[model samples]
Target: MNKLLVITVLVALLALSAESFRVPRQAAAEEEEGTLARITDTVKSYYEQSVNTASNYLESIKGMKLEEKAKNLFEETTKAVSTYTGILQDQLYHIFYPQN
Candidate 1:
């Protein structure tokens, strides 16, 4: 009778330990799901913000005249080229005409 009681207690402890292990696994599964949900939300938010930015940019440029755009682009290009050439010329002058 004492042996049977000991066996019963051991079986009960084993069963309880098995159940305790499952609780942690269930909690881990829930935590993983929560993390996934947060990641999905963040990605969706960035996607929405990107779409909004593109829409705003397109709206702002929608009414711009092609000729005006071309003129602005040309002016910017000319300034950049002039600045680059000036720098090059100065470097070349210093190299060839060192004021020693």
Candidate 2:
């Protein structure tokens, strides 16, 4: 008998408490709108940032004058050729002279 009474009271309390926590439809809709706006703004910011970075990178690369690039390339090539020629000359002299 005591267990039965306890079950009945618990069921009644659960029914009463359930209605108090219900969210109003208007409030739920407002929250959803705010979340959507925030997500859209975040995505738009990322796209703009990416586009700006790419534009800056291209501009910097374009700023490199062709004359400067060619000068740098010629200097590096000359250095490499000189080193190779020196090595070949040493090898030939050693073979012909056969120093003891």
User: Considering every candidate listed, which one attains the maximal lDDT?
Assistant: 2
lDDT of each: 0.70, 0.71
Query: Model 2: residues >4 Å from true position, as ranges?
Result: 1-33, 66-71, 74-76, 79-87, 90-100
Model 1 scores what on Cα lDDT?
0.70
Clashing pairs in 2: none
lDDT: worst 10-residue window of model 1: 17-26
C-alpha RMSD by candidate, in order: 20.1, 18.9
After TM-score superposition, the amount by which residue 35's alpha carbon in candidate 2 deviates from its true location, in angstroms, is 1.4
Q: What local lDDT score does residue 24 receive in model 2, on the 0 to 100 scale?
A: 53
Candidate 1 residue 85 Cα shift, in angstroms, is 0.4
lDDT of 2 by residue, 28-70 (tens): 5445444445555565566567769999988888797767999
In model 2, the worst 10-residue window by lDDT is 28-37
TM-score of each: 0.36, 0.40
